[model samples]
Target: MSGAPEDLAERPVHGVRGEPFRRLLTTWTATSVADGVRAAALPLYAAVSTRDPVSVSAVAAAEVVPWLLIALPAGALVDRMRCRGTLVAAHSFRAVVTLLLVWFVHSGQTGTFVLLGCAFLLSSAETFADSATQSLLVSAAGERELERANGRFVGAETIGVEIAGPLAAAGLFAWRPELCFAVTALAFGFAAVWILRVSPEVEPVRAAERRSMAGEIRQGAVFVLSSPGLRAVVGTVGLVALLTSAVNAIAVLFVLESLGLAPSTVPTLLVCTAAGTLVASRTTAGLSTRFGGAPVMTGALLVLAGGVAALELVRLPGAAWGAYFLMGFGAGTWNVLSSANRQRLTPGPMMGRVTSAYRVFAWGLMPLGAAAAGPLAEVTSPATVIVVAALSIAVVAGFCAPVLRRSLP
Candidate 1:
């Protein structure tokens, strides 16, 4: 189904300056900060609690496994529900879960199982929030300003999740684990409040047009599969995510054991990566516009591969920092361009479902990659697994290049 002509015409001509877009950005930034805290805290806590690679990686796996389990259903639900309400509810749920996690940590019940359960629940909430947020973005910024809006969104995410969030997590986790979680809960609460202020230009689906959940889901899947461009983007992204997860699952371990960095320094190292993402957030749109989306994306993957390979081969703290920065830059560029392209291609009513379907293929493999990393690292080394992942990403880039060149604008 097509969007209303009036809605299309009424989109802000001034880029992402609309009130709805501002509120959505605020909401996303708050949520990103909360996510960053939990993300950094979990692995750090797990590493200290148990040195077992499998156990540590299991925590990482639990967080992303929801993408596989609930992303599609959540997307369908988001399409059916109001985006603002869905976001509010999701954030509220996350706040409650985080409070529970705080209680667990305070009670000295910081077991692997407890961490895994909390991570899974929190990530499940994220699935809904993310799907609804993407749908909301379309309404807030419209198609014309999607690249700029997404660039700002990615910048917020980089700063909040990667920079501010991790830094805060490091300090708070160092001070008291429960304190870190308490802060995360507060962030989620704030996000709920912020999103409530957004007044998006929503066009509700008519009752006559509504279908069964399964049918809607199938329709989304069919749409994604039928488009060769979407298929190439989805498949390439899925492969990249799989390999990247393997590298990330063991990253903390690599820093602590291989580089001999202190726990406090870990977040600082992460900040370097965030710095690169911040740079890309400002530059990706122009780069894509000048060079075309396909070439930029393909080159970004190559840059990421180079970063990982450098990290493996060099093994110095300075080199590690630069490598991560390069990796983040490449990732940020690819993410912004890919998301804008997808949003541009999709119909308004189908946005949520299509986004979810895309993610089911793109991000669903993350758990498998993360889960395997620990065992693989145990057998060889974190460095070995990382380099292998880098090589795999490079290979996928080569195979997907021609399709991306042909399909992406």
Candidate 2:
């Protein structure tokens, strides 16, 4: 497919170079660097500046908990506001938060408990920016281009969030903790400027009576529930989310206890996963375009099942890392198609709510899996968790296989 038909509203995603996609990639990379700093700096800040684990944990949770708590209202706000403006404002806020941390750290006021108050404020801004930028992608790419657009965004984020970003943090943290945060502040400032340049072409909505917050929330939830395609994809992603969360929490314990490996080995195993992730991203374009998103999703789910199953019976250290990489491959595959499919199936105005609803569905069960793992491990052994998780993926894939095969992109 050289290009989509000229008459079509959205261009065909033959390759990954829509203007918005390019800029989005650039913005994500910069922001990812900032994230990398924060990821490393958080613990370092506690270790050096203060020794209270509770405060450190609270700060960490503060960064993520708001995603679940405020996602819906944030989505509605995205629907009402200019997405680019919202994103730019969000980034500017992130810069301010980091700068405030810098001031406190420099002033020797970086009390562990005190910092968390700042973190909570920061998380609120993140909630706004993340929801808005996601919504903006819908307009910039249009419907036909969603999969490719989202794939590109995810690929960039993977590098920024998963790869180079962390590496940069590790390097910077060796020097000074305050320096790491300062760098974060700088990244967000640049990102905010870049975001200001993006203006998504929002599609119009028809006149409807204003509703209460509860009604708005229900409207968003009902919209997602009513869409069969969205429901199926959301269901599959949600299942994967639970298993992934468990495995992530357990992989460390597995290596430490089951394999008799030191904690130092964990990053090497995780780093190896980039191979699988990169391979998955490279192939997604061809697979999604030729076979359609459903086929790609099914194949990816099967790979996920196989990889998770492999974790149950590994005997060698090399094989352990190999399994991690393969699992990462499956993770890459599932995320690529599923995220793209979500964007493709949803309209622009609903992107915030839909994305939030999808996030809630996928992540809501994570605590259950994370919490149950330790108890389950004590009883049935760590391998049991791996086995059951693998089996779950296999069963879900089996049920979804037929439905997926019948539906093309």
Candidate 3:
């Protein structure tokens, strides 16, 4: 079967270059901000609800477990459906879920278990939504423009999640916790609307064979594992994700307890991180295209290592901001290049499954890392845990440096 219209398929999707692509970016931006607000609020809620690092980290761990548990099923579902409609439905579900959380918070029904349940529900929906949207972008933008398109998406994410959403959530949390959830609900609702308004000029080619779910999942795994480049990328991604999760699991607590900063200022540190990401977004695509994805990834890993190391040496809030800023910059580059590379390597028909499988390997371990961080912090200090994490990240980077240089384009 023929794919998207030849003319539409040939067109590039950059900033405002195509109407449908622009609409997709808008939807992503809005949803990201909403997610950012939720990200900032949930940890704070968990921390406030219980001072135990394990309990607080449990909330974070619950949110990511969906990636490990439901990502494959969700990807299989997405591959068989209309991606756009799937995205809208998923976002709508998130809005409802967030609103319910708002009600629970308002009624003072939010305990640690309740909060974890809500996070799991919200992220389960997100698994489907993210899979569908990423597949849709791959089908819409075409392979040649993958890096550029992903860069734009990452830029929007940095702005929404790091800059606007966190800052807004901080203020709203100070005023009212329910207000933060309410805003998240509204953002998801609006994201659904904006996505619904998008009119794709092209359609994806559907798979003619009606394969069983298990068959499809296996096919995607085979494709990813057989390819050296994908294997390298996934391995590197998993290690980085683990270390990053470890650091983030207690970042807010570190700032408040270790650095003696007020809770109100945690979001400001996040904003600083976002600012660095924004700067990286502008340059990552060009750098990847020029220097190749591997070298760029290597450089980013080193920068991230440096950033994490810096956090140990400097315990002040200002110093933490600078360290996180560097980490964000590295993260921005890695995300854009890695996503684009995955999109480029995977076949269109298997995009959803392949993406899901990749996430399974890459993000599935995040919960474990987070869970480990808490108990480790209880044994040692958060600062000591982060320093160990930094050393681990550097080791992963050193191992991947030569492999990535050999494999990635």
Candidate 4:
């Protein structure tokens, strides 16, 4: 079968140059803020509902498990549909879901099950939205400009999702729990409207040459497996996700119980992480261009490990802030480079499925790591689990550094 239209090739495409990217960027910023608020609110609500570490972690696990279940199918569907329309629909669905959560919270009917169900539904929608957005990004910003584009995207995400969103959610949650969901619903609706303003460019696989859904899914997976650099990227991402998921699962508990801080302090600490990420996003492209991809990637991982380890050893709040900031910087560097690298490696037609397949292998471990964290923290202490996770991350970074240095671009 023929590839996507020449317009959809790796070269800069018409119609998506100026306005579309701005609209997409605006949509992404809105969605990121909403997602950040929800991310903070859900775990905080769970912790307030019940102090059981297992139960609390379960809520975090629910947010990401959909990636394991539906990411591949979602990616395939995105490839078959108009990305702009898909984004619109996904954002609309998320808005409705957030509204439902608002109603549930207002009615005082929320439980762990309800929280889990809502988190899962939201994430399921996100699976499609994220794939569509990434596909759209490729069209908007061609391969030659991917690093710069991704850096901007990552910077906005860090600011909205990690910094501004979380800070607002914490204040809202503290004042009135339902307010958090209400703001999130509004953000999603705003995003849906703004995304509609993006150019209605269609880049789906041609109907005449379209393969079966299963075939398409396998094709994307196969493409990723066939490339050594992609293989290394996926492996490293998976390991990093696994370890980081554990830390995220228990982060609230660690802040509240371990550090003996107020719930409000959670977002304050996250801001530190976001600060680091913002710096990394701005610098990752330049660093990679100068030093090479492998060293930057490996060094980022080491930095993350150091941050995680510091969190366990230090007992002071200032120390925790610094550690989280370091972790965010490391994570930010890895995320921006990896995303740009993946987009550069994959063909335009296969972008959706390949991105989804990449996530299925890498992010699919998030739930497992989150679930395991609860039990481990229950048996041991949260600090112990975090330290162990940090060590594992270090080990992976050390082991993969040489291999990636040799393999990656």
Candidate 5:
């Protein structure tokens, strides 16, 4: 009880500063590169190997399964454990898994099943790393600067994971898929090293008494579901994730088959979208500061809807790139505003659980979205599926706006 006010008072009006914040940001950037590389390389590997939309979707779904299955328990564990240690351990685990994957690729033994399994294991590690990082940032940056901190974090991620990672991986993947995996392993390994060097003070200590994981997990779920604002945010993000994942599930196929782009050139085209994301991350804090988070969120969603719809209409490369750019920009802005709002609403002790619970709805539905994408593309056209997703996203945004406006911090 006594700590609540002290924690509240920790919020600062200015951007976060100091060595710890820098270290955490560095770690995020490094690991995002690893994620980016894997995201691009692995999908291409699947598409190259199987050439089946369903199989590619399977790989995508496998990556997100941990978010649905283990998120709640992982949240509970995060609340009771040291976040920094978790970060290091998770990255280390990913590094080892990636190395094994490289070996499989080298031996020419990699298949759809093995790729899917590896993706699931690597992303399971990500579940821990992501949850722990969110909790750690609250301590390092304080609640007030969460918007800025998350913006910077997102910006770095967009550049590394969305932009640089894809481009680098595309090049390496074109040469030898094994080289891409080696780079991913190296990135995760380095991220662990940076996180290890972060000072002790930056890591929050959650005093523990032996307690049932079920109870802790329940507490987190109740906190999120009991709050209308959190629920609204979760609902809105879930819808977007569903739609976005569906589009992305077939994105490579759309580019290679529909757009007539080569596999090696896919990442280059995506960089247009990544550029929008990078710009949005740099600008979202100021936009929210001026227009307010709720309105900003609403406006960004409108852009996303329009951009996505435009993609279906446009066949020219320039026009399609523009559409993807708009989607990325809107997505980037919405992410910053939503994340900062969640951080502000959640208490320190419950941060881990609340964040994970939020993701269960927000991200867990991605597999469903991915699964839907393949069949939908087979029946109709990929463009038709994207148009439907865009319209649905717009409706969800409109429906959630009033609740979000009333609830946002």
Candidate 6:
């Protein structure tokens, strides 16, 4: 107990300074190229190339489906492989795929189904790289530094996700969309070189004992389902993610029709949310240390609930500003608390599997949320749908309050 505080103080921040950190950043940037550009550009490109929402959504779903299907197995593979090799190979393959995509686009021969199929393949490789990258850091840095490592990783990845290729994609699409894919391909190649240079501190995976993949998958599923503490955390986060993804789908409708906001205001308003998330990621450590993850998470969810509820009352004048501000703050803090909670409870070796499992739930339901938003909005309007979402947040937060207040040793 006496040594605990000192141990915490010595934590190393991943992707923060040090020569090796550059490699991590470069590795991170690889994913960012595809990430920032994918949501808008991919779907929009699909529409222009072929007006098929079914095909476009399939592309989006294909990208996400791999994460749900392969992430756990990828995590297990990470535990058994050389991390650097996995990352290097993953990026190298990504580069190849992106280049092939670019060539197809340049030839004006890109098809809706072809793009969707390729998205699945690229997303599959990414699953392997992502798990290994996550597992390698804590394995190298020791358990104590997991928070700092993750914090930096989260912040850097967030920034890249927020910025990176979106700006370029927008520019290059106007000039030439094909060039944009080529640029993305180059980014992946740069990442591959960076990862190849760094050495990974590999960990042994003797527990597997060469077990069947299906058996191992069942073991992971059982572990996640059986833990009440973890379930609460994942369930709460999943709820938030699902709801927010839904909110995102209807945000333009809310801003334009309900709140009567102008087009120019959209960027400024969206930036506020991004700013809040960045601030939250930076400050998560302090909050988690003070209140512990569970309490902070509970409060974050409650705050998010209040924010959502406030959306119900957002009228003209100062009310609109305040409601949106609260929403940004709540959403931002939720990510901080959820990430901290996951890192705190999970052991280093199991971090990959647990994180994958957590994501399986948290991210898995996002499509459902997006799908639900349309019908709900059609039936009850965007504002009412969000209010219903707010109530769900409130109910879940109330249920978790007791667990949240209990301190971890």
TM-score winner among the candidates?
2
lDDT (CA) per prediction: 0.86, 0.75, 0.84, 0.87, 0.85, 0.71
Per-residue error for 1 in candidate 4, Å, reads 37
Better candidate by TM-score, 2 or 5 = 2
Q: Write the residue-wise lDDT of candidate 1 on 70-112 in tens digits.
A: 8888888778877788888999999999999889889887788
RMSD of each: 4.8, 4.0, 4.5, 5.3, 5.1, 4.8
Judged by lDDT against the true structure, how good is candidate 4?
Answer: 0.87
**Residue 155, candidate 5: C-alpha displacement in angstroms:** 1.5
True-vs-predicted CA distance for residue 306, candidate 4, Å? 2.4
Error of 6 at 155 (Å): 2.5
lDDT of 6 by residue, 1-409 (tens): 9999999766643444534555675578667766666554666678789888788778778888888888888776765567788888888898898799888888998998779977887888888887777666654444555455555666666556665667667888899888777877787788888777554355645664646766656665666666776777777778777987888788777877777788777766665555556666677667777877667767777777776677567565655555656676676666655565566666655655676777787788888899999999999899888888888888888887786555332
Clashes of each: 0, 0, 1, 0, 0, 0
TM-score pick, better of 5 and 6: 6
lDDT string, candidate 2, 275-345, tens digits: 67877877786788888777778888778777777766767657777887787777787787877777777
Residues 1-409 of candidate 4 have per-residue lDDT tens digits of 3666664664433332466777888899999999989998889998997787898889887986888888999999998999988998999999998899899989999888888898999999999999999988877766667777788899998888777887899799989999999999999999988887676365888899789999999999999888888898999899899899999999889888878888878767877888899999888989988998789989999999999999878777489899989999999999988898898888877888999999988877877898899999999989999999999999999998888877666
Using all chains and alpha carbons, the TM-scores for the candidates as numbered come to: 0.84, 0.91, 0.83, 0.83, 0.84, 0.87
Candidate 6: Cα lDDT at 351: 59
Model 4 error, position 222 (Å) = 2.2
The residue pairs in collision within model 4 are: none
Worst 10 contiguous positions by lDDT, candidate 2: 7-16
User: How well is each residue in 67-168 modelled by candidate 5, as lDDT tens digits?
Assistant: 888888888887777888888999999999999999999999988899999999998889889889998787777777888899999899988887788879
Candidate 1 wrongly placed segments (more than 4 Å): 1-14, 42-61, 103-117, 249-268, 312-317, 371-388
